[model samples]
Target: MPATPNSFSVLSHPSLDQSGGGTLSSPVTRPVPLVESTDLLRGSKTVGIMHNGSLYRLQATKLGKLILTK
Candidate 1:
């Protein structure tokens, strides 16, 4: 049997400066599936994120969109 791949990787290219200059920085790379927002949403209409001791709500709309509110 073929061995299953254990992990995934993603390659990101550096952005170039618009002032006729070369690349602004070196490329950045990371593992695949960096963030799965859906997983965090977890079939819920809202999720809470706390920042500076304040709670923020992220809501999923009927139009299949997201809205963040403090």
Candidate 2:
């Protein structure tokens, strides 16, 4: 199902906090932006992403998998 406008997926990463003394019990929640595959592909099977000074290729395979290459 598609996500609702107010709904999203969240990921948590655990980190060590020396200030709290062995405090890795609580995870840190960070919001990651979600993008649909169709939106990225936009009517094509491949798209280019420019990061830093390099270009990366994101391609959708025939088997419905994605590949990223530098």
Candidate 3:
């Protein structure tokens, strides 16, 4: 990844890498930041996130998967 982001984020994990089709890899010098969905939602099924002048909705699906949309 670039030292600084140039956009193109549609929900990607920090620990995931483009190599090998997005596999998890640990950083040698620093730990990745992690945030639990429950903590973010605070018991709600949906949450609104503001990013780059756009409002996005993050929803928890019935199958327990997360979906983010603008």
Candidate 4:
């Protein structure tokens, strides 16, 4: 079923802090898809993620698993 306005509002609203402080700010204001794993590994066994001027390797193993290495 599609998400209702009430449900969406609750999910997007701030929550009370359990630490007895105050309501915690909600960080997620909107939904966004960063990337899909299947899309990244499509037609390939390895993909790279660039960070801090470095390339990190994400590989699909023979056992049908994934590994990320710096």
Which residue pairs collide, candidate 3?
A: none
> Which model scores highest in TM-score?
2
For every model shown, the clashing-pair count is 0, 0, 0, 0
The C-alpha RMSD of each candidate to the native structure, in angstroms, is: 7.0, 6.8, 10.4, 8.1
Tens-digit lDDT track for model 1 on 1-70? 5533544443443333333445645443534344455876998889999989999998889998888999
| Model 3: per-residue Cα lDDT over 3-68, one tens digit each | 333333233565355456555464434433557788888999999999999999999999999999
TM-score: the better of candidates 1 and 3? 3
**Each prediction's TM-score against the native?**
0.49, 0.63, 0.59, 0.48
Count steric clashes of candidate 2: 0
TM-score-best of 2 and 3: 2
Q: Report the alpha-carbon TM-score of model 2 versus the true structure.
A: 0.63
Per-residue CA lDDT of candidate 2, range 1-70, in tens? 8878755654443333434555555554555566888899998999999999999999999999999999
Lowest lDDT sum, 10 consecutive residues, model 3, at 3-12
Off by over 4 Å in 4: 2-34
Predicted model with the maximum lDDT: 2
lDDT: the better of candidates 2 and 3: 2
Task: For residue 2, give model 4's deviation from the true position in Å.
Answer: 6.0
Error of 3 at 17 (Å): 5.1
Model 3 C-alpha lDDT versus the unseen true structure: 0.71
